[model samples]
Target: MSYIPPHKRQTKGSPLLNPTPAPLFNMRSDFNKFRTWNIGYTDHTILKWFSVGLDDELRLSSLVSFQPLSPESFETKSGIQPLSLVSTHQGCNEGIKNELIETPWLLIAANVKKDLLLSFQHMKREMEEAVMAQVKPSVVARFGKILFYGSSSIGKDSLKLNSLTETTLRKMKGSFHTDVPPSYMDYVEDRVAENLGQEYVQGKELYYVKLSDKLRTKSIVSCKCTVAKDHNKIQLYKIELNRVRHMVADMSILGKSSDLRLFVNTKKIKMALSDEEINEIKDLIASAILDSEVPSGIRWPLDKRHSSGGRYVVNAIGHTTAKSL
Candidate 1:
């Protein structure tokens, strides 16, 4: 036998160089055929690399080794569901969208990984130079979750449209389309915020747990509140005061204590909040309570109170974390 060169020998099994392509990707096969499908693979080598071409041959050989006589053997060992590979920008975006819908956790994990990788990169540079602000864990965590949520949500509207009936589909197909609302991602967003808040509250006296739906989604509201019959520019801060009476009475005795703070977004106004929006935020904060969730035994109208300096404050009272007076 003539000695075959190593490179030529290796190329023998390669589906690309092989004159007879592997059975899985054979042009004649009806099941795995993609000639008409136009499922674009960036590299033709992708077929050989991922076993898309050789899958059927390998599967058949494995089946024959077992020597099953059943008709099901032919059906099961011969075919595989073809994946839609993409190369173009639009196609890649669609692929990402499809992937996110199928596996939202993957999106979340990817985002988290990306953020962590970025932070570590930043840290590595900082250690060498020693002048940069170290990335905060909370910031990294927030970004990861946001990326995950955003990637996952970009295609939900298309999915909804695809699910519509023919008549409705026809109507929607021609109609002007608005973008998907951001509310679908509120759960993930709330969970991230909840985790960050918990971390922020560690070893700190968490006074006044604000038990309201409006308080959770927003930390600050830079809208005009109708105060005393005038639309006054109000900047409301979300302060979770667990025990308003106890905390108020405690603060009355011993001056104001330290609390975690956040700023309101003056740019986006809460133009119209649904009943669900209010309730969702309320439930999130209530669930964050340490022990009892009941806000009873707190002072009357605890939220609307003026401090000694004539500054407005809203005390969110909850029984989660508290020390009674």
Candidate 2:
């Protein structure tokens, strides 16, 4: 009998025999193209109060207010003891006062100590009320001026890094104009692309983007990606089916072919598949394995058996050696 190579073999009506063409949507390129516009930013001040039970009363141990810190700073500072518990009210109050002495960022009322000795819940409520009552009026008075005048001045002076508006573009053009007018914009775009690419591609993080709703109804299709280090590129895989199915692994001697078994619940699938569909799925799996660039001396056979099952069991065999290519 004549032998044909795996890649050369052609089965009639096999989708794998003629693989589907690549789509227009290149995930990496498309993501980089719109990364800047899709990027989001927010600025806000947070007020936090550390409390500890003293005697039968709850005391506002420490108060701090600041903008959000980086993940590393937050992680490190979160574990630090903000307030130390003392034996007496005088010591506790003195400790808090000493901590707040140089810290002008915290807005604590003069009567915070007087409001102590209340229930934990009540103390938090009263302290929050007092802080807001004192702070809200001042904020309201200055908000209008800040909104109308301060924002414009700040906007003009601050570096607009990722803004894509026409006004921002014009401002950038005026500030960094050279003999080649488009060079600066191109450089900025490339830098933004490089940053995003480094973060998502080079970083050890899996990227999964969901497909459109129009694609399927029950199971939402998604594109999963991982860096193929050997190939020095990203490998994108689509996951369309995610139903909980019984898996049975039939491991054999290393380098020896093992039975590829798939057990599915008929009720879950909800329909009986024609032979053509089964062949297509099998062919697809075979094509994927064939297309994969396996390490030299490794051989993974394209053979599988489908069975209906409620439970599945896996079996392992002895070690086998592979011949070096």
Q: lDDT by residue for model 1 over 125-150, one digit each (tens)?
A: 32343232221112211110000011
Residue pairs in collision within model 2: none
TM-scores of the candidates in the order shown:
0.20, 0.18
Instruction: List the global CA lDDT of all models.
Output: 0.24, 0.24
Error of 1 at 249 (Å): 39
Q: Show the lowest summed lDDT stretch of 10 residues, model 1.
A: 244-253
lDDT of candidate 1?
Answer: 0.24
Residue 88 lDDT in candidate 1: 17
What lDDT does candidate 2 reach at residue 270?
17
The numbered model that scores best in TM-score is 1
